[model samples]
Target: MKTESLSQLLSFLDASPTPFHAVDALRNRLNAFGFEELLEQESWKIHPGSKYFVVRGDTSIAAWIQGTESPSVTGFRLIGAHTDSPNLRIKPQPDLNQHGYLQFGVEVYGGALLSSWADRDLSLGWNDLPEKQNRKNRRTLFFIILNRF
Candidate 1:
C-alpha cells in the first residue's frame, strides 16, 4: 500500500509542472472523489457530507469537507499544502540563439539543485484560455518538452 501511494505521488509530481497545473490536478482528483467546484463570486449552499473547492487565480486553491456536526461544537479539520519545485521557467520571448544553436531562455524559479538536472528529459507546460472563460474553464493546459539543450 505504501509503494502504491508513493508511486501515485511521483506520478502527480511528474504531471504537475507548475503550481497552477498542480492545483488543477488536485481539482481533478477531488472531482473523481465527488467534490464539486465552488465559485467565490457566487452564493454557497454548503451541506453536510458534501465536498467543494475554490481556486484563486488558478495558482492557489482551497478545499473543504462539510461535516454534519456544527462547527461551534465540533471544530473543522483543515489540511494545507503548497507546491513549488525548484525548476526552470521559460521567460517571455523564450526563444534564443547562441552560436547558431537554438535555445529557450529559462529562469530558475526556486532553490533547485542545478547539477542534478543534467541529461534529464525536460518539458515545459502551458495553459491558454480565452479571456471570457478565464473565470471558469480549465481545459486549456498544454506542455512542450525539449529533448535536448
Candidate 2:
C-alpha cells in the first residue's frame, strides 16, 4: 500500500475502537463516495448504477453499487468482512479504588492478551444509549494511559 493509504488506514483504525465506531466510520466513508443510506424500517427505491449502504444495530453495515445490467445476465459480485477483533471491554460497574488509585474493571471480549495490555495507552469506545425515548444515542470514545507501579 502507498504511504498515504497506510496513513489513512491507521487513522481509520484509531477512530474505530469498537464495532459500533467502525460501522460509523464506514458509513461516513461510503457517504463521501456518494452512497446513500438505507434504513431497514423504510422502503427502498433502488436504481441501477447507484451506490447505497445499509446499517443495522449500529454495528453492522453493508454497501453496494448497483450495476446497470440485470442480475440474470451479468451475475452478482459480493464481498464479506467483519470489523471486530480481540479486545478488552469495560464492565458495567467499572469504577474501582485500590491502593489510592482509581481504576476500571474490564472484561476480555475475545482472545485478548491481558499481559500485553499492561502499561500501555488504551481506548474505550461505546454507544451511549439515551434513557428518553425521543433522545438519540451517542457514540463515546475515551483514552487513558495505564502504568504499572
Candidate 3:
C-alpha cells in the first residue's frame, strides 16, 4: 500500500467514529464520483452506464455502477462490507455520580475487548436530533481521555 492511500484510509477512519458518520462519508464520496442518491420512498429509473446509491436508516448504504451490457449477458458482481465495529454506546440516562466522581453509563454494542479499553483515549460521537421537526439532525463528536493515578 502506498503512503498516500494509507493516509487517506487513516483520515477516513478518523472522520468516521460511528456507523452513521461512516455511511455519510461514503455517501459524500459516492456523490463526488457522480453517483445519484435514491430514496427508498421514491421511484427509481435505473439506466445503463449510470451510478446510483441508496442509504437505509442512515446507517447502511449501497452503491452501484450500471454496466452497458444486460444482466443476462454479463452477470452482476456484488461486494459486501460493514462499517460497524466493537465499541461502547452511552445509555439514554448516562450520567452517574458515584463516590464523588462523575461517570457515564455505557453498554458494549458488540464483542468489545473491555480489558483493552482500560486507560485508553476514547471519543464519543452521536447524531443530535433537533427539537424542531423541520430542522436537520446535527453530528457531534466529543473526545475525552481518563487517566488513572
Residues 7-126, model 1: lDDT tens digits: 999999877988878988988998999999998889999889888999887878898888888999998778888866788888889888899999888888889998988878777787
RMSD for each of the candidates: 2.6, 2.7, 2.6
For residues 1-149, what per-residue lDDT tens digits would candidate 3 score against the true structure? 69999998898888788898898889888999899999898999999899999988778999999999998999999999999999998899899999999998988899998999777766767775556884445444344444555
Model 3 spans with C-alpha error above 4 angstroms: 97-102, 135-149
- Residues 44-143, candidate 2, lDDT per residue (tens digit)? 9999999999998788999999999999999999999988989877798899999999898988788877797776765556677556784455555444
User: What root-mean-square deviation over C-alphas does model 3 reach?
Assistant: 2.6
Q: For each candidate, give its TM-score against the true structure.
A: 0.80, 0.80, 0.83
Clashing pairs in 3: none
lDDT of each: 0.84, 0.83, 0.84
- Candidate 1 error regions (>4 Å): 96-103, 131-136
Error of 1 at 54 (Å): 1.0
Pull out the clashing pairs in model 1.
none
Q: Which pairs of residues have clashing backbones in candidate 2?
A: none
Score residue 91 of candidate 2 by CA lDDT: 90
